[model samples]
Target: MTSNFRSLPVIALLTILSLPLVVMYAFTLVDSITDAEPGSLIPSEFTFHHWRFLWDDTTGRGSVWIATINTFIFAGSTAAIVCATSLTSAYALSRLNFPARRFFLAGVIILHAFPTITLIIAIFLILQFLGLFDTLIGVIMVKAALELPFGIWVMKGFYDTVPWEIEMAGVQDGASRFMVWRKLVLPQVQPGLSALLIFSFLSGWSEFILPLVLAPGSDAQVLSTYLAYFLLDDSLEVDFNLFKSVGLFYALPVILIYLAFQKKLMNIYGGGSKG
Candidate 1:
């Protein structure tokens, strides 16, 4: 009797939990099938035109190639810079001792919590002063800096979970500090690094505010800006279904990648994030 009662509650809880997801999926499915104007949710019939149209795009206005490349470049460069700067520096903070280390570590974390939007004006002025306003490389550098602090903090926690004695043993064997970290420490934190790469790439990939504020022309524009272009275009009629189609295609690859690696991300960001 007790077992049956417990099972009933468990089943009830699962049904309740699943309700929101079912609703959301139904909404997305309806959105995909509908051909009405941007505001309408109902469709006369199902259509595959949007999906098929992505490949046939020659309008120049809807070219996925350009925006795809921009996204890749931004995400790739940001991940590289974040991993390079954060991995080594964070390892140093975690394993090595120095004066003012705690203060420095706290500041690193505090800076990680700083919102990216708040940096826009300051970054804009700085880039303007350096004569790099609206440059792809400049945006890449800013994204890298934005990613560095959080990446370092995530890595620091991952490093703590690794036994320091492993690196210490390397040191006692006459291995230089640099060599010990490179060969020994890094290998232990590869999972966290992978998670960091995925996350930092996603952030750079999806970030719109900074690039929107900073990108001076199409030369430096990424996917986010390109998406907004459709809404802003006065020359062409706004096509809501086409906009949603483009969005889904652009988002599909990243979504798949995230889903594939989602199970490990919590551990990367949470499970091992403490001293």
Candidate 2:
């Protein structure tokens, strides 16, 4: 009871600080489903007109569902590739002692330090050379490659936390190195794995610039790119309500994913090694 009493001020302070965001989100939600007079903030009447893009190609670029499907595929593929490669590479980095291991680790950090925008022109040219420009698979590969350094570093930290005894025990029992890693080490770092998976998925899902710059076709359009069409179109009078609805639609999956795995996401920093 005393702890609760003591926490009241902190809770109240947080609530006060968050009030504007809360109100803004509330207003957005309300505004999406309701009509407002020009130059007026208050919603005047409820309507589903703004949400028609769900079924209609109102943007003329493509159906919202196509963008959604592409977004899902991009995010899901990136997450899968990152997780699979990160786990194996991190295990090797943590458990193996190859030449230039430290140099490799240093290089990983250096690679991650460079911003994505700086590499875009080179990546764009490389994709063009490979005949992969403006392709979904091309963008997926780029996103996964850019994400790998962070994924490998984080997974290595988690791998460092796993005890050698468990792995040794498996080896002593006639298990191969692959078997030990798959059955023992993998299970121990489940939290980090789950967290990394969710994080990578969220990263790919929210990525705007890469998809916009790389995969501009309607066939490869992701939600982030699709959402930008509304703001960029000069032909249509600005429809703020429709924009809000589309924004809400784009954000719903991310919100749901975060809410569902919030605990695991929070654990990302808990077990990782500093070095």
Give the number of the best model, judged by TM-score.
2
Q: What stretches of model 1 exceed 4 Å from their correct place?
A: 1-42, 46-48, 51-62, 270-275
lDDT of each: 0.80, 0.92
Specify the poorest-scoring 10-residue window by lDDT in model 1: 266-275
Candidate 2, superposed: residue stretches over 4 Å from native: 272-275
- What does candidate 2's lDDT look like per residue over 1-275, in tens digits? 35635787898999999999999999889998999888888888999999999988867988999899999999999999999999999988999999999998999999999999999999999999999989999999999999999999999999999878888999999999999988878888889999999999999999999999899888899999888988987987788889999999999999999889999999888984332
Report lDDT (Cα) of residue 252, candidate 1. 80
Error of model 1, residue 142, in angstroms: 1.1
TM-score on alpha carbons, each prediction: 0.84, 0.95
Q: Write the per-residue lDDT of candidate 1 for residues 80-194, one digit (tens) a residue.
A: 9999888988888987898899998999988889988888899999999998889888899998998898999888888888887787799999999889888887777888988
Give the clashing residue pairs of candidate 2, or none.
none
